[model samples]
Target: MKWYKKWLLIIVAIFVMIPLFIGIIQHNKKLPSHISFEGPTYKTDELEFLYDLTYQKNEERVLEQQLLGTALEIINEAENFLVVDMFLYNDDYDRDKGEYPNSAQKITNALVEKRKDNPTMSITVLTDAVNTLYGSTNNPYFETLEDNNINVLITNVKPLRDSNPIYSSIWRPYLQWWQPSQEGFLPNAFNPDGRKGSIGSYLDLINFKANHRKIILNESRAMLTSANLTHDGSSYHSNIGFVVQGDILKDIYLSEQAVANMTGYTLPDVTFKSSNETNGELEIQLVTEGKIKKALLGALAEADEQSTIKIGVFYISDRQIVKGIKEAAKRGANVQMILDPNKDAFGIEKNGIPNRQVAAELVPNKNIEVRFYDTNGEQFHSKFVIVTDEDETTLIGGSANFTRRNLADYNLESNLVINMPKTHVLTKEINDYFDRMWNNDDGQFTVEFEKYEDQTLWKKAFYRLQEFTGLSTF
Candidate 1:
């Protein structure tokens, strides 16, 4: 009967269409980022770490397998010193307090264990003054650290701000000369014991920040990440850490340690044994920011002759970074950018509507490679990049992203760029990851830039204006 024939046709269509629909959705070249609140590890002659973490895309361990291996290797081989900087330090193991043991805790434990093996071996941890004051005690990681004799230092603090906005704003003229870095407009009512004589409190002021994250092992390996020392940051939220080896670790450690001293924090003299250093002709640069946060984007502009750029980020709010990515790819750098694709209603959407959409637009560029990621299922929350220059000097690791605020003028951002490890294994893994992301346009349900590229001129103009006023940061 005709009715039976219609049903059969419909059934066939449903079966065939389902596969097509999935195919359409699953195509994307952006590789599947790791899904773990737990930090990622890689191998290197020496291991490195970056700790201060607030956003993704700027925090995830975004390099190849070998790099992770290098991290583990550095830890295994640390013969001398291990220095770590953490903006957030927690010890409360109770899940009720926060989340699981983050990478910092793991590293802390590892350091303690390592110290037991070598009493002559020294371990130094520079934590933000804020951490010394804040966080839950359920885990008590900090107490263990203090027991271990790790050096604990707090950054400087100033005065307080008037609560009344009208009065606060009106009184600015008289208070203009008054600097919180020196003394706040008014002395804080309550101050911690160690913070006596300081008029302003560390909690009330905004001008000062001590965001620093790094982990260096025996001048061999180092890690850089955006994940804090909280539970949500590790098992529940998202975070990324990079492990680096070779000579670059020492340079980066030195720069960051210097910033710590500038913030009125006590620090030990840090320098690597020359015998352990590498002389790879690879181009390596160390960028850092704290009280003196470095210009992250300006450095990117300097990344000419780049063959490929691998970006993993947590938060991006810098406009200059946007322009730089566009400019770099437009100028022929094979840029593969991976981002947190949490476009759901529950998520806190960033970079506004138009700016957010521009992210989709940048994906399909002829020269650039873009992969939007949403791996909340496991854990792919981090911000970093794996960049290869034209001459083939690959730079891996750090806490910087090509965002308006991160690279230009916003929250303090720090990064450590080191020469690629001698082993080609990690580089190849990263390349493969990028290739997967670039071609799997539908595999990951990515938004196509081509779809929006054809928008009319007027519509584009309207969206551009919206980008400036509508969005806070992406």
Candidate 2:
């Protein structure tokens, strides 16, 4: 080959290896220490944290009695307007058909019912087009609203229509790339479900994430929830939801509205109906960290002043988070962790980070308290943080995680810092559950949920080689 071609191949090889090298190096770095959050604080109390824990527990938190659904109810009853952005939305009863019952249907039904009762009320449902479970009934939940003239906007929507991932990613990519002028590619890429895409628009479905999940319901209520509006997420599987009551709710809702407009979808020119901007003595701020590592790390650094730190998350691998907790513990903060040890939560033992060796090293810290729970049958997926101030005010939950992606802006995540006058009973309940599991010798000791009892000889051999190779990044 010519020198230029040889150099070109070398460049590509280096580029490919660079990402792998970075990933491995970061993975091998020592975890950070615990620290308290003493930075600027949000003293708003109206916002509270709610999680729908996996069914693994006999009882942790349920949808019927939880604050998340009630908050949605309040938004539906809004006299001003209701706005919701979610990946999953239900127009039918999913759980009755052997699906798990969650928040989507009950909330959607409530909105539909509310719209009927109050014809003049304005409501908008904005969803990621990819998540619409359009079926034989035609997304009745959305249709019912649309037929009634309720505005609905579907997002990250390509023109293509197909239920198969292979069809969308593989076959579609090849055909569209090779036949740029093909009629099907453009139509299929932009006109998913035949409801979107201009007649002549041309584009393929790329962008793996176009707005994973977001919901801003009305001016009075807003949520940065991890649960999609699906049966498994809401009723069947474990999930987490956070509701905002003060000005932040309105601020977030409007911001999401702006995102909707910028992305080429239209919605009513909506603004916040009046809400109390002055939320009592608690300091509050809306923290949205998505891949801007430095910005999110700063937020975590500020949160290191609390004496008691309770962190709930779906994925926690942020070096800064580990550092924050460890430092806070060093600073005399009582750092206690309640984590889901089951690999399904973040994948498992050998295949994932909750590796026995890693967890063993992490738990040995004297100042930090770490407790892992079995989430085998259920999914223990909740991401929120509760910190207590000197005066004992409670900081509510949010979307930011102790992960590189959440804080470093690699991925967009939102977290709300609310100062409640007192820690709500619900927060105490969650903390208590953590305590119960942490204190007990075993929730069900027989089963070490986080550990892997089965591993092939090849996998073990590979890991041994990894250990010996000093390939700490692996």
Using lDDT, give the best candidate's number.
Answer: 2
Give the Cα error of residue 250 in candidate 2, in Å.
Answer: 2.6
User: Over 4 Å off in model 2, which ranges?
Assistant: 1-45, 48-68, 90-98, 118-120, 129-148, 157-210, 214-216, 230-234, 266-279, 291-306, 330-332, 345-361, 389-396, 420-430, 440-474
TM-score per prediction, in order, is 0.58, 0.64
Q: Give the per-residue Cα lDDT of candidate 2 at 32.
A: 20
Give the least accurate 10-residue stretch of model 1, judged by summed lDDT. 31-40
Q: lDDT by residue for model 2 over 1-474, one digit each (tens)? A: 999999999998886666455444433333221111122443454555665544323445333235456556766658777776665565233222233444666766677787887888777777654443221124556776688777777653232122223223343433334322222322332123333332222223232233344565775667677666533333444556677665565456545555456456555665565555554555666555432234333434544445577655555665566666666666666666656543542112225443333334455676565555455434445565555555553443554445443454322345555554445565465566555445553233123324433245554454445433322221
Backbone clash pairs in model 1 (N, Cα, C under 3 Å; residues 3+ apart or in different chains), count: 97
